[model samples]
Target: MPYLVPPHIPSGRIADGAQPALTADGGLCLRPWEYTDAPAVLAAFSDPVIQRWHLRRADSEDEALDWIEQWQEAWLAETGIHWAVVRPKGGTSDGAEQLLGRVSLRSLMLGTGQAECAYWTLPAARGQGVAPRSVTAVARWAFDEIGFERLELAHSVMNAASCRVAAKSGFSLEGTRRRGHLHADGWHDMHIHARVRDDEASCVPVEGAGPGAP
Candidate 1:
């Protein structure tokens, strides 16, 4: 599919362009973050499960707001894209703007025609297909509207859930590297998954592509 430069920005520049807000089942909308979202974003990242899964660092409310501000700048700069997974009012039993998660496409390799995908969801949002659904939505948009020929994602082997999200989003298991990153605990092995445009329909599975896919 041909990439559509977001209506608000030109093709080559990196500012003011954005992916459209996407609606998921249950009236959830994945839309670009706003400055007003700081509080909810802080609360979402403060969850122990998200911190453990993504190895998020400690931060004060001000620091968190700064991070969100930086993300906003980057999003408008067109260097990367970030979205907040919001559960709109009156749709869910909670009746709140549940900041379920965040997803991103970054590290664009224009020469190589590739980009990296990343995401993390609150524990309350896990096991409900949120991560996979969000990842797939972004991947599709990346290919169809962002002009990427391939997408890549990496996760520590211990992050079985993330690996599963990559698979369910259509990424094929690529390979593993030993001790690629040092996290809070120690060095950990990493698995790399990739999806190329040509293989979208027949990508091969990684180690756990079935019921044990994670």
Candidate 2:
């Protein structure tokens, strides 16, 4: 007999060899980040727009490499899964294939089978549906491939573009966290959005800890 208790999901760490290579329209490919991707990582974080919302910045080549290392460590520790959003056949940069953006399943709260979704896009990749497409793909993988029960997304309320992405990516607005984010300017309110295993047009706000991840 199935009791009305929290679902039990198998606990496992994210391994690059086991990670699925997800493809989408417009020739987009989501793959595990590579050591060679350091340059693109540096270039992406240097963008003021990306740095604005994504407080974590890789100031130099070494820092960029360190950033990637943390992701790998997170995977081994079962804390996060990150994918380098790439446009294999569509984008170009100085005769190289540049990263379109990055999507991550961060803040892996395994006990509750929940994780947070975060992303940052290349300046050239914005305004073209890259973020939303990548987000949707990662969300689907989180739910279907990895058996994650809940995924959350939060953005500074001032970021209208992020708000739109969250909505289009199937994350319904859960609620707001007052004075949740601290930007270069000041503390800003945050909008929390979430998608669950059987979510529909609407979703209830996550209780307790507000959805604010960095």
Best by TM-score: 2
Q: Write the per-residue lDDT of candidate 1 for residues 27-142, one digit (tens) a residue.
A: 56889887778777778667766666567743667767887787777766666778888787766787767777888878866555677887877656667767667767777777
Q: For each candidate in turn, give its C-alpha RMSD to the true structure in angstroms.
A: 6.1, 6.2
lDDT of 2 by residue, 1-214 (tens): 7657654454563553466678754567888888888999998877777778888678789888888888777777788888898877436645556677888998888767899999877766766777777777787777777778899999999888788778777798989999998999899999999999886523222212111123
**What lDDT is obtained when candidate 1 is compared to the true structure?**
0.70
Clashes of 1: 2
Candidate 2's error at 24, in angstroms?
2.4
lDDT per model, in order?
0.70, 0.76
Q: Can you give the TM-score per candidate against the true fold? A: 0.82, 0.85
Question: Once model 1 is optimally superposed onto the true structure by TM-score, how far is the C-alpha of residue 94 displaced, in angstroms?
Answer: 5.1
Query: What TM-score should be assigned to candidate 2?
Result: 0.85
